[model samples]
Target: MKKILVVGLFLIFACGSESKAQAPDAVKKTFQAKYPGENDPDWHQDDHGYFEAHFKIDGIKYRADFNADGSWVETETSIKKKDLPKAIKDVIKDKYGSEDISEIEKVDSASKGVFYDVEFKQKGKNKDVEFKADGTIIG
Candidate 1:
């Protein structure tokens, strides 16, 4: 009984630590260099193996993603519907005027450049749509 209890406890602790793994030193340094003076970032590993740092700047929440080798992948911040670009707003008004926007995020990425992620609830399910600055749908 004692042996079994100890093994169970050990497994629990090991699994917990794995889930709470810290970001690599290189990633931390890169983050500091990019956003100096901003501290207290909560780090997590995303599904794509990227290190994501959740923090706020000037009271605006931001999530910055960095590669394990310290390369910046992207940074995103939530924005209001009214804050969207005029072209995007027009497109949404024309196509999805009836549907309410659930959330909006402005993403700046290294590969795909800058884009907006707009989410809407359709048929009791959430759907995300990506758009470029010119209101062209990318995905």
Candidate 2:
């Protein structure tokens, strides 16, 4: 009985300690303000020392990054190909009709407007395309 109690206490402490290892209070507050109901999210420090939150809403997965000062940097979310704009789909089909789309992510940043990053595979080549919300290609 004593061993079981000790194990239980250790497990609780370990779980709680993991949350304490998350980003700073400022970052958490910023994330909370940005995504009000998304209280529980996976967090990690990026290469640039920013905090990244991985969460899901309405069945869509998203990642929001906050800088050290708690400023929102950017956000990315996966999108379905069928949901893409008609012009964007037309362009992709015209350019790489033979390729298979592997992934499509919509990214919004403070420095740039909303855009989609599409990753596709063609034969033996892998490529990525960027498209603005207006369905215009941007490199």
Candidate 3:
């Protein structure tokens, strides 16, 4: 009886872990079709009820967010600060001269053009700023 109980418990734990590691079928299929990459991706459900795909293609890391129904939302990818448009970089540097930029991400959206979101720490507080393609601050 003890042997059987141990085996059952092991199986239950294994099954739970396996299922948690898999993304839902619809979300997985949509990501595979859109990404069209050779590598498998991981899926996560965000607090906003959106499915997000975290993967890499051609060696560049990316996270693509999708709705529950498999509709594409946006992709967030890290980018070098120098890769940003000169005007945008200049504005950021000039405005936040004291703060150091920790990270920059390129946000690609279906409905809007690409934008850069920069994360910085200022006076012990963390802040993020969004800039449009033309160097204008949107948020």
Query: Which is the leading candidate under TM-score?
Result: 1
lDDT scores of the candidates, listed in order: 0.90, 0.85, 0.81
lDDT of 3 at 18: 22
What TM-score would every model get versus the actual structure? 0.82, 0.76, 0.77
Local accuracy of candidate 1 as per-residue lDDT tens digits, 21-93: 4889999999999999977798988778889999999899999999999999999999999899999999999
On lDDT, the leading prediction is 1
Per-structure clash totals for the candidates: 0, 0, 0
Tell me the deviation in Å of residue 116 in model 2: 0.8
Evaluated at residue 96, the lDDT of candidate 3 is 86
**What tens-digit string does per-residue lDDT give for candidate 3 at 32-108?**
78877635677667767677778887789998878877788898999998899998888987998778888999999
Pairs with steric clashes in candidate 2: none
Off by over 4 Å in 3: 1-21, 123-125
Q: Model 1, residue 91: displacement in angstroms?
A: 0.3
How far residue 100's Cα lies from its native spot in candidate 1, in Å, is 2.4
